[model samples]
Target: MRIPSTRTVPTRSRTAVVDSVWSDAKEFLTQFAQESRGATDTDRRLREVRSAIEATGTYRHTTEELTFGARLAWRNAERCIGRLYWNSMTVRDLRHLHTADDIAEQCVEHLRTATNGGRVRPLITVFAPDRPGRPTARLLNEQLVRYADDPRSRQRTHLAQGLGWTRGDKDFDVLPLLTRTGRDDTPRFHELPSDAVLQVPLTHPQYPAFASLGLRWYAVPAICDMALRVGGVTYPTAPFNGWYMGTEIGARNLADTQRYNLLPTVAQLLGLDTSSDRTLWKDRALVELNLAVLHSYQQAGVTITDHHTESARFLTHIEREEQHGRTVAADWSWIVPPISASATPVFHRYYDPPNPHPHTAFVHHASAADTH
Candidate 1:
């Protein structure tokens, strides 16, 4: 929608139908009307919502409201540092589709649309939400697409294998999309076609042999398995994506102890002294690895940001938000870059601690079992 603002969002309901749910919905609609600058008819919409709640157990969000709420969720995401472009994200309304097959198909489409031939775009595809009598469909992968056989994803890999999927003998195979229509439905797996999944192979700018390590990462990091809540409505299958920050691939995914643990390998390739931690071999290797990630994505014509630039943009986002009469909520540990945490401007300040409020639109963390 080009960020002009149009989103429809609904909530998962249990017992809040008559009392708490309506109260939460009222609070959200009020804020939405206030922020909408009186474009919305708060009184009329409230009446409609009140009627819907009395007749059914839930109220549906208008498409415009959904779009706005989705963007609001992005802005309110406490752990994210790239919220400056939250409003720019595309909200795909696929709420009508509730089957495992339909969701898998649109997920593939979501990847293609977000990838945008290496020019990654921020996007979210909201699938059918849970309702009173029926459960919602959900994607079972932590991400819509992930490299196969990575140590960190072995649990998911095994789950796919248990579902009668074969693992190809490739270093970085894209795992199949696992889905479940409801709590009782047996999960299904759909392999992602190659054209829909874009990947960048890692190569250092200076080291010619670095490419031999066969390091790679998918272009779009579509976070699946997270629950999207709007006005008390919970969408269990809302998948979203933003362009990668180099450290997400270089500092943590590839270099973490439990993951690929490639720093030691890169250190030897760089001829760094590895006798002890005092040698600072890991430090030298991390910098080069990060450099490689940034360089490779640039050369491949893909969207990626370095830790330094992103941190600066985050501070800008806060300034812009403050000017709009809003306080940007941030978590210090997440706002600070994992690599060179002290050098970034975000390192100099204390941000608002995690203060998530009800009656707010937000994307929330899901349990590990949610991936199943």
Candidate 2:
């Protein structure tokens, strides 16, 4: 019943390659003169970075390794620069050489070349004002102009965007307020961009599938469990039961339980009688089941945060359970059966330690004859 401990050697080689590519890109960017158009610099740098990255075998290995999230992160960073270049060109001073259409065309051409003659198109959508007073396109244009003229505009733009203030107006503040209050007021500026949406077809569809499966089945639950334990006490405004239901919370809970070997107090909190019979059992059972599943994950080493300590603890728990004469069910076996190659079963130990002893040995033996 002692579960074997396994070690996973962390792979830093891939990360090292990515760092090398980044260094090469920084060197390439330094060659560009300050007087040159920003768009031109961005375009040249993106192409150079991509080329350098591909040359280093990072991109190829990631693709082969099916590290879709990493690949997507790289692609998105390049795309963001490309989009920024276009936006800068459109709002550039007349003294600057390139036209908006010219810059846009250059972007499309670069994408096609990078993708090796793949179909690439830019789509544009419009953003309208929201109720309780929203900003107009004119106001947004003014803000864009202000941003274009200012030297510190890039930082400001990032801040504004992060705050959901894409278009400068009263609605920018309004949207954040509404979001904080959990009120969905169909705020303005939520619409798609005015220009075309750039569509990039992925090379392999199954790559995404693998990335999604890992996050949902493993990463997410662990993250949820951790976040809840660390931040739960302070944020008691909402019912802990409702909070636990969220994916983020669930993930944090799994992580915390695996790491600390402790179940969330929220489960016990939820188990308390809340006047209504329907509400009490439903809430309690949900929390307890989540805790049970997390325990199962820990025992199987599927979500163990620290292998050195946790693995030992898990094996000890398994051994104790076995000593108590518990049987492993098919659903709770940690080892994969030959019959079902794909199924990942949970490891669980069932035992009752507090039962009283049944027999009085002295009375049953010679002590009874002596008394007679």
Candidate 3:
């Protein structure tokens, strides 16, 4: 699946919302800490942090960038995984161009369109220089320079060596030629193609770039994965439900702090019941985590195993209780049968004694019979 792209507007808006949420969370934590020490500086510190974040725009930009990056990472991860399993194309297929010029043109087009029409050029790699009709690396470089130097060329461009030609070269000085003529010109490096590879860089500017390639609902799994990471779980197949439960509990703890001043209705919506005992809190947290996992898996087109029969039964009971306003007969006797053992072993004999060797048996000596 392609990575989802963020639009200009929502990207900005999401940054703001996430920033606010983080600020509130931090403030709540600080207040809780202060309360433990019986200090009254919570309100002052909260105001100071909020104003600082707002003034510096740090919260907005950082959160926006983070959200974008996470989304991009999720998308690229899916693509990489998909390619591992399914892609039939190879590097040679991608590198096939009619001529060196054609390849250069294709690279230039990609740079322009993909990078927002930036005035940047591509470094082309030419192979097999001595062979008939194959363009020499030197000749290709010259052509790129000529194209960039043309008066009609509104876009400033540059060309540099690719690995195929760069080999054995010691004192290459193409940097000056590729450098911008004026300070206002766009600066883009035409790195050797070997420096570039098929794998997406985690630090690429587009790492956080958003695209609307798939359904928005597909984001649930991605977000859940991020949530898991935030809670310090490293392995995907680990008991992520427990980690999610811990996160919910942490969020509840934050909500209960005086700094949050969370509305009772909002708290309830978030699965936080202030009056619940510690044991109930733990149970509720686990249930919420399980529900989140179920929802996320469903969004990702995964089916949960029928092993959660007990959970299903419990949910059914709760629904019945709400609808009837009274307790109904509870059937807690459901039992899953154990696997049965294999049937009794049957031995197959390959050889059979001669049906009586009647003559030999009749002739058996008295001594032989006694020995037998």
Ranking by TM-score: 1, 2, 3
Of models 1 and 3, which has the larger lDDT?
1
Q: Which regions in candidate 2 have their CA more than 4 angstroms from the true location?
A: 1-272, 275-282, 285-372
The digit string of per-residue lDDT tens for model 2 on 1-372 reads: 988778554458656766655553343243222212333545655565567555643221111111221221212221111111121111111111122233223323322322222121221111111212321111111111122112323343444456566554421121111111112222122222323222211111212222221211221110000000000011101000000112122333222443221223333333445456665544443344344434433433332122223323434544553685632122222222112223212123322322122110000112101111
Task: Give one digit per residue, the lDDT tens place, for model 1 in 193-294.
Answer: 999999999999999999999889989999986788888677788899999999999999999999889999999998889999999999999999999999
lDDT of 1 at 136: 68
- Residues 1-372, candidate 3: write the lDDT tens digits: 998886566667756864754554354335334423433466665565566545543222122222222222222221111111111111111223434344434443332222222211111121121223432111112112222222222122222332122322221221211222122333223432322211111111121221111101111010111111110101110000101111222233213343222234333545466685653554453334334433443434432322234334434544554584632222122111011101111111111222221100111122111111
Off by over 4 Å in 3: 1-49, 60-69, 72-188, 193-195, 198-372
Output the TM-score of candidate 3.
Answer: 0.16
> What is the C-alpha local distance difference test score of each model?
0.85, 0.26, 0.27
lDDT of 1 at 86: 92
Full-model lDDT, candidate 3 = 0.27
Candidate 3 — worst ten consecutive residues by lDDT sum? 231-240
Report how far residue 139 has shifted in candidate 2, in Å.
27
Q: What would you estimate as the lDDT of candidate 1?
A: 0.85
The TM-score leader among the candidates is: 1
